[model samples]
Target: MLASILMTVRKRRQPIIRLALSTMVAALLLGALACSPPEPVRIGFLGGLSGRVADLGIGGRNGAMLAVEMRNRQGGINGRPIELIAEDDRQDVEVAKQAAGRLLAQKPEVVIGPMTSAMALAILPQFNTAGVPLISPTVTTNALTGLDDQFFRVVAPTAAHVSKSAEYHFRENGLRRPVLVCDLRNKAYSESWAGDFRTAFERLGGEIIAEVGFESGQSLAALASSVLAEQPDGVVIIANSVDTALLVQQLRMRAADLRIATSEWAATERLLELGGRAVEGLVVAQYVDRGSTSPAYLAFLRAYRERFAHEPGFPGLTGFDATNVALDALAARSRGQTLKQALLTQASFAGAQSPIRFDAGGDTRRDTFLSVIRDGKFESLQ
Candidate 1:
């Protein structure tokens, strides 16, 4: 009888011991987790990941992703891992606002991109209301410049690029009578660039014979005919790569020997792939120097190709530079200082090919290069 009683007591105690062990294990795990590290620092990315302009948006997103990946590989900002949340704006105003709203809801420290000026304008109000700064890689419309708002960009305004191209055409290329073609789809960028070019070109004693504006889905043949009818010596196209390439082909079909120049908005590799022989001899200005041999740029180029399996174009280079600017400010910010304040406080930040300095209004300027397509490649005119 005593043995039976003792056996029952042992079995009960066995279960209690097992329960204690399980509780202790769970407690130890919780303790370890608590002692590990803080939560990740969240960063939001917005761009047109789909649709016609996906090339620019994807490149910018990839560059931002690369920056985040590289930083996380090393000990992230102050030992906190960075979590990049990317959203596709779809290159539509409504979609961009929705994407921005979603990103803002996540409460990221900062958001990088909406690669074009139109998209930036669409979502700037949301970012401003959320108190999160929007740092763009390639939005160059002059509309956002000199604003004390939350918009900041790594590239200069439209005037910086188009004004230089105008001077180059007038003085270097000797194209006195030039016609302008604008893409109405991205009116913010296209119109801004065209207006600036007109101002500069006219100021240099060059005459603009005609100015034509059309949307992307319009007939290129009719557009080309309209542009050619002006009988101008030179033509400047302000559009995206796909549109630019198609229009160039149309123009080449009619005027093979006419001089053609394009704004930097169309200066992507897609333009070459799509334009082919038609794009040869087409002049353009770009913020990124493809022939750069700087150590920082070369290293970034290698890493980007290895990770993305493609070349990082102007969008990628500028996106990487923009992200680094935000990261630098985040790392150096005082306990209560805002990201904008932190950025403005710094004198300069390191860029892939050059140094980046932001003015009091969060605007930055970089070197622009004039290049012409030679044998299907952009060769610098410098």
Candidate 2:
């Protein structure tokens, strides 16, 4: 009888031990919950933040962070704060790829952009392979977006802009026997734009007198003199602002009868600032109005100035547009849509530059606006 009583006591002890252990585990879990911090959803900005294009990216990042901050102030998406991780591409393709890789390692919900067509093209294949969507701020080569199901952009295709410019200037303005000076060997955007200009001009019954390929380091004076000797009707330059401005100034000095037209890449304040009076009467083709009167553009311009203490250019606005779209996708992650899909859904976005809308093929086809420099500013050619 005594042994049976002892066995009963031991069984009671076993239950008490298990109950105490469960209580300790529950307390530990509660403690962990109290100490752990909520994870913020990481979004990556891939761009040339420190090189020649720093102005372009700084303004873009500023605009995007403003949007994110506004969203966060509203208590965030599903109680998760959005955080931005910016990586500098230095305007180089190899550097862009490395920057993208670093961003992907952070496992961002979406990647903003590499900013240059060449940079975007170099980094997209990796993101696509990983099923991560990339949204370009302004790299509009069309080849980047139309390549796969993963790439997208808020900026209208630079190629289409080039084509439209050629169409209007060659057909409407009667610019026959034009000189084509393109930055062929630098980036795909320029090369493609040059081709489009040639095709459109010839199709409109205009002749290309001389097709010249100038390197980034070539002297604008020499190039202008060489092209002027050909006695062309107009000058079509498919290059960046650095080269474009130099060429414009040289052409202004050499030829009074020559008309100058630059592509989307040359749409920067640097052109007007550097080219000075030479940029006057020069036509620039772009997807967005430089001096836009829309409320959205005005508001964005204000915000960008407040954040960065300066005005935004066309590239900066494209960055903001791309960022806002990507952020919208990220905030809506619970709805089973990706950054690419959200952008590609043909949703019209009132961007700082223009009303941005992208097709299913990741191409953004928008109306081109022709603007001319007047009084040191770009004015709509009404």
Candidate 3:
């Protein structure tokens, strides 16, 4: 009976010993974790990787990649590496929403795109609810101006920048009368661009002789004929590169010598390829001056060309600028500050083209340039 009582006592003591040992292990693990370096910061990049406007999305993604890779090569932010999580929204609203849901689950502190204004609008509300900061590289919808949300952009608003283009056409280009052409499919961008340009040009004593609309995959011959009938001094084509190419080709067939200009919306490689000789001598407004020789821009350009075998254009340049802005915010976060507050309070960022500054409404202000297509390449006239 004494032996049995000793056995019970030992069993109870064994439980107590195990508890003590487990507590010690837990404490040791916590100490080691505290002593180790922090994990890499997560950044999400969402853009269209497939579908019609994939070139712009690809360019933006490439730019973001360059920024992240360069930062990593230079020791990253405060010794913590950065891991970029890229997603393709396919430029569809529902797809963008789904992609955003998945990305938010990854808990990225910041996100880099939704390159088009439409995609940005689609996913911004969800990101706002999650309190994640989203900086777009090329979203320029007029409706997004002054929006009280976490959405910020590197490109200027459509109304503001397009108005400047109007002034350029009237004052510098010496075009008194012009016809406006818009793509109805991308009404959000094309309509706003045409409307803003019309309002500004008319205010500057220029006349809009005609307004024409067309849809992609439809014959633009009738629309082109109607526009040429007006015999305007110049034609303003506000559409994506493919649609712009079709319209310009049709117009060129009628009057080869007619002056033509394009909104920044259609400024892409696809334009040069599809429009061919028709796009030659076309004046276009651009957010980035590709001819900039600034050291910072030159470094970026060289790296970009080396990696992609192509020159960086507006989408790439703006994407690089936007990602750098996010990196700055991340750096601030590592120092016990909030990302949103840091972005709002930080000073201007000198970018590839000009100094970029954000207003209280998160709109970006920068200089624009007028470029002419010479030999199927953009040559900055500014």
The per-model lDDT (C-alpha) reads 0.91, 0.76, 0.86
Candidate 3 error regions (>4 Å): 1-38, 229-231, 334-337
Ranking by TM-score: 1, 3, 2
Model 1 lDDT per residue over 263-310, tens place: 988888889999999999999889899999999999999999999998
Please count the clashing residue pairs in each candidate, in the order shown. 0, 0, 0
User: For candidate 1, which ten residues in a row score worst on lDDT?
Assistant: 155-164
Top-lDDT candidate index: 1
Worst 10 residues of 2 by lDDT: 51-60
- What stretches of model 2 exceed 4 Å from their correct place? 1-37, 171-174, 335-355
Check candidate 1 and list the clashing pairs.
none
Q: What's the lDDT for residue 11 in model 1?
A: 93
Worst ten-residue run, lDDT, model 3? 329-338
Q: Which is the leading candidate under TM-score? A: 1
TM-score of each: 0.92, 0.85, 0.88
- Give the alpha carbon lDDT tens digit for every residue of 65-143 in model 3: 9999999999898898999999999867898999999999999989999888778878999989999989999888887
Cα error, candidate 3, residue 182 (Å): 1.7
What stretches of model 1 exceed 4 Å from their correct place?
1-32, 35-37
Cα RMSD, model 3:
3.1
Q: Across residues 176-261, which tens digit of lDDT does each residue of candidate 2 receive? A: 98887877534677777777788877888888888888777667788888999998888888877767888888888888657888
| Deviation (Å) of 110 in candidate 2 | 1.1
